[model samples]
Target: MSFGLEVMVRSALSHIGDLIAVSLGISLSLNNLLTFYADRPRAILAAHKKFMLARVAELSLLAAFALLYQQYDSLYINTIIDTAAAQFDAGVPLHWQAQVAACLIALAALIKCAQLPFHGWLIQVVESPTPVSSLLHAGVINLGGYLLLLFTPVVAQSSIAIWLLLLVAGLSTLASALIMTTRISVKVRLAWSTCAQMGLMLLEFALGLYELVLLHLLAHSFYKAYSFLNSGNAVNDAIRLRLSSAAKTSFQQAQTSNTVVPNAQTWLMAFSISLAVVIAIRSLFGFDGAFSAWWLFALALTVLIVQWRTCEHSPSIIYTIIMGGFLCVIYAALKQAMHYVLPSYSTLTVQAFSLADIWAMILFSLLFVLSAFLHYQVRWRAVRRLSIALFAGLYLDEWLTRLVLKFWPVTLPARTKQQHHAKSTHQPSLKP
Candidate 1:
């Protein structure tokens, strides 16, 4: 793991560094397969197949890169970035080779990040040890984002590649988020959350929010690591929370109320306050293209307000306003900090809204509305049906599981005599 990170650090100097990093990442994943071999033979085999597929995609990306650059010297990171930026500035469309390279890069990263149909292995691997799961989620899964960040210049210029990424990652994000809500096990929920988070990270890349992507990457790494490590206490924490007065009240209210959706007036107030806070912070920090951030902040604050109202424990208006403003301020500050640290060329600067921008705005707005609807309208018949489908992950993974097993079938390891004896010893007597 340390070696993979070190190689990534060198990725800025040479494109070869990314290849090496990806190789080391696959090696790490293969090593984890060893740990899963005995108890989860099927999972190990499936994960191996996925990892090999990713390796193949990475190799294809390397070939595409060579074809696009046409020389070893021009393959250096700075040269590629300069060439891409020059083309972009000149309003020159990307050549077909460059477009292919960009698409290959996105494909490789998506597989590595475990997006959608490629995500079954991520869930299956949870049978492994907790630390292994932590390392996989917190470190290995993020390599995809790093890959995209390294080639941001090439990707930003390829409209086809961007749209491809947007469609896949956007669906993955929404599906995984809703699926997470249906899972009961803590680790399973976290795994689904990781998938959703990775999807969102890739979506950010597709939208050319490189700085925000970096910030999201760092924050998610720390949070996932800690969450996985501390998951043992999750049940106890849930019990305590449920025993609390506020929680009990909220639960009862949710159970008894026929209509849980907040009034339009409440939503309007929340939006107004959140917008005001974001605008204030934006003016202070001089940040641009923060529409997505504003939507997220509003959603979070609205959820909080709705919860408080449901419990009949609404906080003072001033205090709520202050907390909402504080949250927005923190987000803006982190974004600005990332912008200042990264090189100017690494982050794409948007001077005006494009068609892609408008589409992205619509997507985020839909996601916001969908999230609110799913949360508050669980009692609705249509929502209940949708929730059931989501709980089964829309049967997405089942197809992949069947396909992988059919073509490259793996047998479960035979049990040893000692294991068989233990099972017999634990069995109830036939006489009873």
Candidate 2:
């Protein structure tokens, strides 16, 4: 859910370096495959095509905004935002043009972030080199959040746009998360995770958890960079671990653990811990003057509690409490630091908390709870069927891929045996 907070600090911390870094990051990422054309030409082309589509979406959005501002009295972004807010406060309904413009911005961000139908290209990105993947997952994909953060002052006024962004981003997060589990290939799974992470970040932004979104943006970037770079070794480590286990037991392969779903006792314990922690935090911190973000906080606490309860090695209860306390403190401190560094431009108005916000919170909470239930019920027939659907990517991406191919078919000719033989044996005559 969205929150309303009085801006205790109103520093505009915009820096040229931030903009330059983001621009360069995006530029480098889009062209990261340039050096790999000889090795992965087809992959590069596919990614390039996807990038072009995203570029078009962004360009169109900017064009719309430019035309919009031309008709308005102010050219400054903040000034325009202030005027829109004042008008909205005065009971003036948002113009149809503005609503459309906001929707366009959301659409562009959705494409850039690789949400839903736009995600087919990201999956194919495994064909690219590792460095490219690192650059993409670490830097480029994060720009979608940056885009939303940048325009919140204006975009927040459009309820339609906010709802659209919430629904699309929320659905993308759910679908990608489920699909990720069905993938066996490491890179594909990582790509799916990236998509889901990006979607969740956008959803966080929509829910007015800007601080959490910023934290997520930075943390996920570093994590994904390391994950991609070390991905090759992960398979070896898994094999080695399996071999060591086999050596200590029967030669026949041991079944994978089915204890991912916590038993009822564990669930009760986790929920109790989570509730206690929430109550303690609320009593101590007084909701940080924003009770609207409570549900998200509660959800995080629940996830942490579950992680603590389901650990293979039993951790001391006191240690778990201390760790949770440390995490809470660190999160609060980091959120404060982010406010100073990336100061938001918008004021928290009542409209920020809309029906869309409630629906988004409900959807995400349901997804998390459903995920826990499904994990525990892995052996159920219905669960298996759902897994199959998820494995097929809910047939969403498959249909979109076909549509994309039909509209923009790959025309590059393949190097057949005859073509390779001719190229090898009948080289061009040497120039004099």
Candidate 3:
């Protein structure tokens, strides 16, 4: 390679810079070409070989990039590359310098994941089956958080840079999330959740507390995946949607011999497990007094399980609305609690990963095993639900945050409806 070509290629291939341009280009092209050749579903399934082969080509280029870019050569290749290294390497104590480099490297990897060109290949990706969307959302696109988590050890050491990255990403993601409308399939929403969560993870990196972020990522991923997969094609779950809980109760009353299908023992077990989780989380955080969020979460989960088991026996419309409402409430309450109590922190490797913290890896392994087992059931509709839901949750979270910041300007008097109500309530007190 000529010096200029070598410099350009090497800069593009940095550990942090990795294989984005090529992978994105390939993903975009195959996605577009296959879509043109076939209808949405057929193209997705039939073109898997081609799509995967394209991914292989991209990844192979990345591997080559990794090998070639190991030189750290100072041809002053690109301003962006130099700036990133300088920022990562600057003013840190020598002992912690490597740690900072590691974090910058991690940050670069994450940006690559979330920072694709927004040219709209995402739309086609969602048109595949619900399960695929959910898997892509909660599993693949979602990898950014874990990548950030993996590098938290090095990132936490860099005080100013990490915070700046967090703020910029949060603002950008919040803005982008708001612009995304309901025109896209539900899977896009899940993908956006990956964007939003990755932003939050960046914030955690900046904040220097990786444990909570790690915990959050792990828990978040599985639950999100499960939910997206389950809820993706709920439009077609016939018997469950028609009957309401009240109707079921009435039926039980009318027909004494009703089998009650759920196997009460299983219900009881689930409830106990749910309750224990509530108490454990509450104890860990001391939020809402002792058992506050626990009560809300438990109640919602209970209703959800009951609704799920009885959904086949009920009406789709009622079941869906009720289930959706409960889920929203659950999500809102959890976010609120986290905002109030948790200090966002990064889990930099030196901080989060010790020889002792090998346990996290072990725990992750177990989670993977459990996920495999759960996925063995593999209903197409279920996967679709999980995918769409994760994205929607992410999109909604970012959108609402943006809306408040933009219109309400919480610092201003009339920024929020709650603030307006507060002022109104105090006006009477002041007058009296």
Task: List per-candidate RMSD values in Å.
Answer: 4.7, 6.5, 18.8
Name the top TM-score candidate.
1
List the pairs of residues colliding in candidate 2.
none
Q: Model 3 compared with the native: what TM-score?
A: 0.39
- Which candidate's lDDT is highest? 1
- List the candidates' TM-scores in order: 0.85, 0.79, 0.39
Q: Model 2 misses residue 271 by how many Å?
A: 0.9
lDDT of 1 by residue, 1-432 (tens): 123333543554466656667556665655565356464565566565665556666686677677667622475665676677677678777777788888888887888889997898788777677888898889888988987887777877777878888889888887898889889999999999999999989988777677788998999999999999999898899999899999999789879876556888878877777677767877788766535545556666667766665555677778778988888788877887776545554335433256656665666676677677678888779888988898888999887777767876766666656666767899643210
Report backbone clashes per prediction: 0, 0, 43
Evaluate model 2: give its lDDT: 0.68
Looking at candidate 1, the ten consecutive residues that score lowest on lDDT are 1-10
Error (Å) of candidate 2 at residue 357 is 3.8
**Cα lDDT of model 3 by residue, 1-432, tens digit:** 124323434555434454355446545644554444343333343244334434543454344234324433332224334433344456433234343454444445444344322213333455555665555555555444544443333344555445445455545344334334322535565655555555545544444434435555656678668767876456555356446687687677758864344556745654565455555544554433112223435644644555465544654545544554455455545554444333232123223343322332333333333333233333557644543553354343344334434643422112345445667787432110
Q: What's the residue-level lDDT of 414 in candidate 2?
A: 60
Per-model lDDT: 0.74, 0.68, 0.45
- Full candidate order by TM-score, most accurate first: 1, 2, 3
Residue 283 Cα positional deviation in candidate 3, in Å, after optimal superposition: 11
